[model samples]
Target: MIDSDGFRPNVGIILANPQGEVLWARRIGQDAWQFPQGGINDRESPEEALFRELGEEVGLSINDVKIIACTRGWLRYRLPRRMVRQHSHPVCVGQKQKWFLLEMLCPDDRVCMDRTSSPEFDGWQWVSYWYPLGQVVSFKRDVYRKALRELAPRLLPMQEPASKHRKEQQVSRRRRQERPEC
Candidate 1:
């Protein structure tokens, strides 16, 4: 649902495999790739939306994945000017997402992107935890970085020094600038 601040209530999923890699899916017919995510319906809780999206987007049911953790609060990101739907009623300026980290309990063969008549993704892969930071759309780079960084410790140990972490973020930001928006 769209909130007073013009941000839509949404859920972002970060599905991680046993080896510390996160699921990254390519848009049905586009170069864009991202984690499984969807809006929270009018009466649905953040978690309900999460599970629904898990099945809709990735064909994974509740039994196929286990919830590991979620961001303590909403993490938001704004849409670029051209991407905003200005003509829609109660215009959405961006998304305020509750990000969840899920551990995959099913095998890779179980992922079916075309479970629905129309699929959100056509291909998928397992990528390093930090890969999406530099690869997601420009407007979403910051939010992705924040969500991944916050939820990562629960999935894997964070042994890097703070300085190294800062360095990695700086590098991810620079790389994000060089990538093209999809």
Candidate 2:
């Protein structure tokens, strides 16, 4: 629900594979990709909303994922001027999200886009932990970056230096491939 600040209460999911790659999904009929997220219902707690959204968006239940950590407080971002709906009740201009970091404990086959009648994503893939920070929509990039940075240490143990370095290098390679050569 929209709050007095003109921001909606929402939960953002950063579902990661054991190797630390985060889940990225393509919106139905759209090329844009993002992490799983949804608005919280008035009666649902952030944690409750997270699990519900996870199941609806990615077909995962509590049994399939382990909640690693969550943000201490809400992290918010404003919609661009053109996106704000001036006529809407509560005048929501953006989202104030409680971000969750979840580890996928089940097999990949467990993820299904059509788990619910209205699917949030059409297709999904696992990407480097830092990839979403730069790849998500510009309006949400700052929040995504902040969320990932804050949760990384918890997801990646300090002893896994070599693995972390490899992941970063892989992410760099993928970014280069996504760009056109000048």
Candidate 3:
């Protein structure tokens, strides 16, 4: 479903727990982490693709999570130069995603990364909404921030301004401890 602008039709899933922490997963065979996202087939709507992607990537069924809200329209991001697949038809240089925010009603243990033969992710964790904005691949950082910002009002009221400060402090402290001193 590549559009005329060379963007693929896709769905991005932001599955959050009761505490407002979102699910982040490490891409298979890679350390890069991101929200679960997949292409939307011609036959399926964005919502349908979201459920299918949620199931495929996180072993979650529609019953396991409730859709809280979605971005009003598509949010897009370009692939980094090295990551683009120029040989593919339509020369898809990016993805225009309809981001879906889902509330996970099932227990965290129900998250199974290896549900399919070719899994999209290898591991997962729950992190604050803004965490991925700083940590996701550079090309995606802006889109991630935009999606989280737009859909954030629908999330639980835990993302107070002070919470952002606390998280930043936590990250700074962790980084300081992680670096070796001269």
Candidate 4:
């Protein structure tokens, strides 16, 4: 539900494979790709909303994933003025999210986009852990960066310094490829 701060209460899921690559999904008919996320119902807790959204958006249940870590408090970002709905109740200016890091326990075949009547994504793939922050919509980038940074350390033996270093290098290479050579 939208809160008084003009932010919607939401949950962000960072579902990772055994190698630490996170699940990235493409929105139906749109170029945008992001981790699965959804609003929290008025009656549901953040954790409950997370599990529900996970299943609805990616066909995963609690049994299919192992919770690795979650944000300590709400991580928020503001929407640009043009994107805000001035007439809406609670006036959601953006989202205040509780991010969760989960490791896939089931086979990749279990991940489906149409498990629910209204699917949030049309296709999905596993990408490096730091990939979403750079690829998500600009407004949400900061929050994604913060969430991943905070949760990365808790991801256990997989989050070794060498792995993190490799991920950083990969991100740098991608950024270079996206920019035109001077």
Candidate 5:
């Protein structure tokens, strides 16, 4: 919902695995990618909106994950002028999000991108926790970095003797090489 200040009240999701890899999703019919997020409804609380978004965007249920942490305040970002909606009642300028970090408790196969009739993501892959910090659209990078850094300590990456990030990258590269050109 768009707030009185012109910013939309939204919920952002960072779904990470035990290995500290985050789920990166591809927008349907587009090459761009980002974390799963949705606007919080006027009738719903941020937490309630979070669960609905988790299901609608990532095809996840509240029972499938454990909430590790959440932003105490809204983290905001502005939309580039060209992207702003001029005709809307309350000109929405950007989003103010309540970010959430969740760890998947179920097995990897539990992710169902097609769970919704109109899915938010058509493709998804697990990547390093820091991977998307620079990869998301420029406008949202700062907020993304803030969310990841704030939640990193809780995941305790320093405590792990090894990170599977390298392995995941290698597999991705190999698959890319094996695929035939269109």
Candidate 6:
């Protein structure tokens, strides 16, 4: 719902695998990609919205994941002026989100992007936890950095065997460098 300040209450999901990578989905028909997120319906708590959006967007359920962490409060980002809908009632200027970090318990094959009639994403892949920082739309990058930074500590334990983690980081950096930016 839109708040008095003209921001929509929303929930953002970061679904992480055991390897510490997070789910990155392509916007339905666009080259642009992002984490799964949706607005919180009236009278619904952020946690409720998280799961609902999780199922609707990624085809996952409560049984398929464990809630690892969440932002203490909302992280906000403003919409680029051209994207704002001036004619809408209460006109949302941006979104204020409660970001959630969920650890996937189900197998990878279980993720179904087309589970809903109208899917939000057409394709998906797992990427290094920090990859989205540079890839997300610029307007939301700051909030993404804040949420990922705050929730990252909880994923640290999953990165055990320091030497291996270090090696992975080295490889990840090399690949990221080889890939061209969008």
Q: After superposition, how far is residue 178 of candidate 6 from its true place, in Å?
A: 39
Alpha carbon lDDT at 159, candidate 6: 47
Ranking, lDDT, top scorer first:
6, 1, 3, 2, 4, 5
Please list the residue runs of candidate 4 whose C-alpha ends up more than 4 Å from where it truly belongs after superposition: 156-182
- C-alpha RMSD values across all candidates: 9.0, 9.4, 10.7, 9.7, 10.8, 8.7
Cα error, residue 116 of model 2, in Å, equals: 1.9
Regarding lDDT, does 1 or 4 come out ahead? 1
Model 2 regions more than 4 Å off: 159-182
TM-score of 2: 0.85
Off by over 4 Å in 5: 157-182
Tens digit of per-residue lDDT, candidate 5, span 24-138: 9999989999999999887898889889998888878999987777877889999999999899888999999988888898898888888878887899999988899878999
User: What is the C-alpha lDDT profile of model 3 across 1-182, one tens digit per residue?
Assistant: 78999999999999999888999999999989999999999989888898888888899998998777788888999998888888888798999998988889999899999888999899999998778988898898888888999888667444445546776766654543342221
Residue-level lDDT tens digits of model 4 in 29-80? 8999998999999889888998999889998898998777788889999999
> TM-score for model 5?
0.84
Q: Which stretches of candidate 3 lie over 4 Å from their true place?
A: 158-182
Candidates 3 and 5 compared: the better one by lDDT is: 3
Better by lDDT, candidate 2 or 1: 1
Candidate 6 clashing pairs, residues 3+ apart or interchain: none
C-alpha lDDT score of every prediction, in listed order: 0.87, 0.85, 0.85, 0.84, 0.84, 0.89
- Candidate 4 or 3, higher lDDT: 3
* Winner by lDDT: 6
Candidates 4 and 6, the one with greater TM-score? 6
For each candidate in turn, the TM-score is: 0.86, 0.85, 0.85, 0.84, 0.84, 0.86
